[model samples]
Target: MKKLPLKIVLLFTVLFASSNLFAQDFQGKAYYVSKTTMDMDEWGGRDMSPERKKQMMERMKSFLEKEYVLTFSQVESIYKEDEKLEAPGAGRGFRMGGSMTGGPKYKNVKTKEVIQDQEFFGKQFLIKDELKTIEWKMGTETKLIGQYTAFKATATVPVDRFDWRSMRRSNSDDEKKEKKKADKDSVKSTNTDITKSDDPLSEIEVPKTIDVVAWYTPQIPVNQGPDNYWGLPGLILEVNADRTTILCTKIVLNPSDKETIEQPKKGEVVTQAEYTEIITKKMQEMREMYGGRNRGRRGH
Candidate 1:
């Protein structure tokens, strides 16, 4: 038997090692920063004074900017907000009311299961359900985000009924009363195009679908991303949806230290749809309570 050349033997050994490394489970930690822009113009004709609007916008900035950490393996991932110490004497009201995005989200890419630990109005809920299906249209556009070359993908996803945008569009007492009057008068006038509806919620034309734009890198080879985004051929490095952008800032692959990726089992188990219903009912109750208080104050 003839012995192979030394260089060929060395090349074969290196190839074997590389293949083994690729075959092993890939674990990584990705750091993300999310930012959202507030639409101050949305309140342009509202009852708020300009000074009040300015103050509200300033307060909203704090809630819009946040940092998150995502721990992921090839088949499972966990996404959660990076905890930060609150500034001394910082009011919690605005932070609590501004958005419902912060939560511990766990997803299994292989099984298509998602479990989220959500907190709303001092109550905790464990949202367990299948992963949402997004029909993403892959685009040829590519951009470099940090060190990775990411390909762009777009998808149209239905807006959650309890999303911040929908909550913001909820009718105030004055608006509801005006809508009711218009609807009653519309019955008398046979103008089909009057655009008056008995349901105040119907009057608020919230966009039924939200456009999602994501930049993903095939180098990662993980079917995972921030929030509810997944199912792409590559790992999503950046996502733009619903007026907010979440971008991956750093990624550490196959770190020596490994953290457990376990689903949250603490809160009451509920589906995402059920949680939305709970939020809607709670908001209605809150509106009624506030409206009653305002009426009482005027009566005095």
Candidate 2:
């Protein structure tokens, strides 16, 4: 037989090494310290006016709950090596009259004012995330979390803290106007209004720090987790990604009734099948009471 070329021999050596790489047969819990960022750009466009930013910020705060989920997956070259895995990102959008806002009564919810398109995988989440890179590590240890034997690991993600304030008109516009008139009269009578040194928006409360901690396991290797958190060595167990938290509800390994875990892609921002009722129901009620066709009209 002719001598095998060195290059081909090296290639075979690498292949052999890869084949010999141990198949991980362990599981563990991943934990995260969760947080939330309310950004104007969560709506996709930017350069908003101060008032608009405030309004969107307030809306975002009222809309997004401070909790989310994380997932893990097993690793195999055949499954994860060549696939163009998409890192989970977050984006915001709306139902365009699909929810209560989509109904005939709230047709005037500004057409696209409500953010209905924020996906757990739509934007890269950060909290003081100046490094802009996901720091990761993986290890071996027999640990258990939610019925899975998890390995221990650690990672640090930097992020930016974001919050918002705004004024949204409600059916009580007239009442508010009367209140404002009363306030002005009181201030004029007191004459101290001219000397009052408080900022007009002193009541606005915006947080300034967001730090997150994450843990992941490769046992499930799905490259997914609760909203806007991903790209870990394994399924993240607990995440302190921001102001919100996404905890693993349950974990299963080779169950007698194994079922494919499919994430829903139809709901609006931060909304999964699990959380649809709390938010969607309230939205419907708000539309019925405040924006009813005959109730009243308000301004932004």
Provide the overall lDDT of each model, using Cα atoms, as 2-decimal numbers. 0.75, 0.37
**RMSD of each candidate relative to the true structure:** 8.4, 17.6
Name the weakest run of 10 consecutive residues (lDDT summed) in model 1.
192-201
Error of 1 at 238 (Å): 0.8
Off by over 4 Å in 2: 1-133, 136-143, 151-201, 241-243, 252-300
In model 2, the worst 10-residue window by lDDT is 101-110
Return the number of clashes found in candidate 2. 60
- Error (Å) of candidate 2 at residue 263 is 11
**lDDT of candidate 1 over 224-292, digit per residue (tens):** 999889988667999999788999999998889988899998888999889889888876666556545
lDDT of 2: 0.37
Please report how far candidate 1 places residue 297 from its true position, in Å: 4.8
Q: Residues 1-300, candidate 2, lDDT per residue (tens digit)?
A: 899866445434534653433244422223333334544453433778889777655544323433221222242111011123333432134222223221000001112111122222233211111112345564444355666444444565433211221121222566557556655554445332321112232222334434555555444544444434445544556655444554565554434443332222344333233334444455445445433332222111
- Model 1: how far residue 91 lies from native, Å: 5.3
